[model samples]
Target: NLVPLLVPLFVSAFRRADELAMAMEARCYRGGYNRTKMRQAVITTADKVAYLLMILFLAGSIASRFIHILV
Candidate 1:
């Protein structure tokens, strides 16, 4: 019963995908051809420090959740 309904749905999805691909090809879309970013992405020393601090904080949180403090 469900298979009959799903066959058309699958065909419709594939048809739409094919149509989109054709349209994109017709427009000469080369998928990231000549793509340029306005500002170049760079990871500086400060970014590295921030990432290290984030990792330490996450590790601290996980340790606190699993480790019990003994006084």
Candidate 2:
């Protein structure tokens, strides 16, 4: 049956995936050293403003929901 043929092929496919995963993990472990970041990230005034706005929006949503629940 073709099923018998497919069983080995599936087994080979899964085996290859496991091998690739291990190889990738090993390569990443080795590659993490001697890596230089391209840009130094800094948060500025705009980021602070955006964060405050998001917090305000979340609080307003919660307050509105609570008000609705009481009504």
Candidate 3:
């Protein structure tokens, strides 16, 4: 009962996917060559400060656990 209905749905989905792929190929979407390289992100002073804070927080969390065990 269900197999007959599901077969056509899958066939149509595959056909649509083929059409979309052809359209993208025509538009050079992620195609080989001539693509510009993305700019690299520079770490600013704020980023460095955030990283320092995160490291400090992690160290404090671990130290607190050890201190609890000692006490």
Candidate 4:
């Protein structure tokens, strides 16, 4: 039961860390306004599908655990 919760939390934290690192790398401290984004970040369909599947599976696992505990 706790596994489902922890896995998603860890994954989210890791993704956030990656985003922070990328933002730091993209930052220019020289106060220059002539820079363009090297890579435009866009959400892909695959990412959306994966996120949905993760949520669905997590929900199912939690529900099953709760039912088991109740029974």
Query: What's the distance in Å from true for residue 18, model 2?
Result: 17
Better candidate number, 1 or 2, judged by TM-score? 2
Q: Which candidate has the top score in TM-score? A: 3
Cα RMSD for candidate 4?
18.1
Clashing pairs in model 3, backbone N/Cα/C closer than 3 A: none
Candidate with the larger lDDT of 1 and 3: 3
Query: Which lDDT tens digits does candidate 3 get at residues 1-71?
Result: 99999999999999999999999989879865778889999999999999999999999999999999999
Q: Which residue runs does candidate 2 get wrong by more than 4 Å?
A: 1-37
Candidate 1 TM-score over all chains jointly: 0.46
Task: For candidate 2, give the lDDT of residue 31.
Answer: 64
Off by over 4 Å in 4: 1-37
lDDT winner, 2 or 3: 3
Model 1 ranges with Cα > 4 A deviation: 36-71
Best by lDDT: 3
* Tens digits of lDDT, candidate 4, 1-71: 89999999999999999998878778743335666668977999999999999999999999999999999
Ranking by TM-score: 3, 2, 1, 4
Query: Which 10 residues in a row give candidate 2 its minimum summed lDDT?
Result: 28-37
Question: How far out, in Å, is residue 69 in model 2?
Answer: 0.3
What local lDDT does model 4 show for residue 47? 92
